[model samples]
Target: MAPQSNKQWTVNGTSGFDALKFNENAPIPKLGDKDVLVRFHGASLNYRDLIIPKGQYPFPQRDGVVPASDGSGTVEEVGGQVTRFKKGDEVVTLFNQGHLGGSLNPTINETGVGGVIDGTLRQYGKFDEQGLVKKPKNLNFLEASTLSCAGLTAWNGLYGLESRALKQGDWVLTQGTGGVSIFALQFAKSAGATVIATTSSAAKAETLKKLGADHVINYKEDTNWGETARKLTPDQLGVHHVLEVGGPTTMAQSLKAIKIDGVISIIGFLGGVKGDQPTFLDCLTNICTVRGVLVGSRLMFEDMNRAVEANNIKPVVDEKVFSLEEVREAYEYMWAQKHFGKLCIRID
Candidate 1:
């Protein structure tokens, strides 16, 4: 039976984590002809989830929007016309519902969940049949929750480029141990590519190595860690793919770390907005392609799930699982960068 009311976290008319007001009686919308009613079991956090409530995200966020894009759930009820999913199937949310395949554009960007529309920080959500994909058979809901954003972004960065996709023996450079970087490290290794990861602490470096990073560079000790990473590659030509998440502060080094005609997937700006930033001249000097990545299409998400299942790539989630009421605490923890891998919320 469809639930009479939904329990959820909504963006109250305020800023910051304090704005996440929990409502136990929000109405569950009626399903459209092609819609399915989902009972979410888990949801994961991303950097954007922190900034969106604070009015810091660049996208157009709706008033009172449910505030998480990554969620895993079971189809509890399906509309009569829905064909892709049945009532008992396990599914994961698609970050951009309209993006089925091909390159991203404004239309697809506007379809971003948790921003332009209501999202999954709730017990029940109604989605078009196309908005969710089947979860990997080997992964439970918690592990699958990490995929919609971070996992897919990493997959897109590594394999979205048809002509320059990650290949066997290629060297991949990943920054820090954030969700995307960790996924990149794991995915690259699965594809038989060598991975060089960067982190500030020795403890994290050890963790990175255990995750299959061929070499872990301590950027604090070796300020020129990019050059260090480059030299580790054959003939010192530099890494084939650079996951550039650090933005302004790290771009210069990323330039130094790339080979001629290499690819730098610009993923985020976690390293502060103000800094001595690199310019286009540096890109010319490095002779690399800097592509801005904003998650990926649903097709790519499906492809990534296949890879995750085939390679048994379990996502690294933090040990402390937060309850729905603890969403604010989860946000604060992510803001402090205190947790390793992805932080998730149990939707029960």
Candidate 2:
């Protein structure tokens, strides 16, 4: 039987992670015709999760709303018209609830889970049937939790543009050891592409190599790591895909590393907003495309899951585990950049 009350963590304000408030008895949402009640087994953190609580996100959030978007759970109950899911089925939340396919629009921009609506941090959540996708069978709940945001973003950056889909024997350049970069490495390798990864730490470079990065460059050691990466390619022609996560600061280097007509998928701005940036003329001279990625759609999530299951791709979660009650600590850990891959919060 479903419980009458839901336990959840609510955003207190812009004060910080410590201001997050835990509630023991929030009302269980009344199911609509197409709604399903999910009992979350696990949840994962993202950069947006850290920034939203601190009022750094650009989107407007509902006051004291439940926080977090990446989650995997079981369907405990379903409404009469809920067709996509049923009791006992395991599912993962979609980061953008309204975007099932095609391109993103203004309306879709307002439909993001964690920032624009009540998200998956609660013990129980009522979601529309279309808002959930079947969890990849090969992954555990914790591993599957990481797929909703970072995994999908990586997949979109690589496969969303059909004309430039990653092909076998292609070259891919990944930046740092963040969740998106790590997933890009794994996906590119699975597709038979050679990957060149950049990291400041030698320890992380070694980890990248183990993850099948064909070559690892220590960015700290080589200030012009992008040129170094380009030189590693055949005849210095450069790479086919560059996962551009380090926004303004790294754009100049990415421009140097990309091959003519190659795709540079801009995913994040971890390199700080005010850094030496590339100009329009630089992009014009590079003869490459700079595409911005905003996570991905529900259809993309489904497609990525199938590929993940077929390839037996397991998401790299951090060795440290946090219970639901330790969500604040999880945020702090992510802020410190101590985790190599995805950080998880196990819902007990």
Candidate 3:
């Protein structure tokens, strides 16, 4: 068999991302007993990708590392033992490829896509069949690309609330208009929950309302946004679920905006690294449950796709398409927080 050729963006030893033009000179990514080879169509960026080069989340064995954990494409080949998918099926990679579900394993945590292992940022990437889910038929490649990491985090954070289920007419609060927060709004609305979405831009607040947010708060205008969130919910009981993406800096306010025993999903660190520690005393007083969420597993990814398919949920994609060569600029745009939604790189 002839070897395949592919273009990949690689960060060599924490320097910078550059085009690494290479022939797939190695074996055609021979599937493990249960793996599949996907030809990537699109990939979306997360804040973690921007922090990699700065050593915030350092990869010890960094050579040939492609930095993106979210992508969707078609399966070109599959292992002999693979049964979930066949050739030419559309699929996306699960964020934590090795960890199937439940409590995180140290070994599984150590080897994650785009971090310890090479990720889906390349034109061709391989993963265990268990880590791949059929893309929702309603979504195109760009929309499907946003789901692996951000979508799962929002789903797990909101729906995974153990204390109380998010019923219709209940209110859910999201901190910003980033990928996860935007997904939170879409999902909350689809689940018949009202969304009180907050953003720094009034323009974005309007956009949020269009996306079915019941109320939008300009956090920049209202410094005490927590009180505003409480006012939006019924009888000052506060929101049922707070999609708490702003860690530490906004944790106290998130606590204030939740109903007694409401769930707060702490998902991101965008509000300055190493802010003041959360006051657990206040959290206890409010009887709020703070759930620390990493991106979810393969099972959650499949379940989320089901929900997306059933609800016909469309991801709010801030399209800034880049070729493989423009990888650095893509990262820069995401870091600048200029994009309203996911920043995608087309790899075909």
Q: What lDDT would each prediction earn against the true structure?
A: 0.92, 0.91, 0.81
Q: Which stretches of candidate 3 lie over 4 Å from their true place?
A: 1-3, 15-28, 58-63
Off by over 4 Å in 1: none
**Alpha-carbon TM-score of each model against the true structure:** 0.98, 0.98, 0.93
The weakest ten consecutive residues by lDDT in model 1 span: 11-20
Clashes of each: 0, 0, 0
Write candidate 3's Cα lDDT for 115-134 as tens digits.
Answer: 77777667888888888889
The residue pairs found clashing in candidate 3 are none
Could you tell me the lDDT of residue 136 within candidate 1? 100
lDDT of candidate 1 over 1-348, digit per residue (tens): 558888898887546888889898989879889998899999999999888888778876787889899999999998989999998999999999899999878887888888876888899998889989999999999999999999999999999888999999999999999999999999999999999999999999999999999999999999999999999999999999999999889999999899999999999999878968988888887888999999999999999999999999999999989998788888898888889999999998
Minimal lDDT window, size 10, model 3 = 18-27
**lDDT, candidate 2, 66-173, per-residue tens:** 899899999999999988888999999998889899999989888888787788888898888999999999999999999999999999999989999899999999
Clashing pairs in 1: none
Clashes of 2: 0
What local lDDT does model 1 show for residue 56? Answer: 75
lDDT of predicted model 2 = 0.91
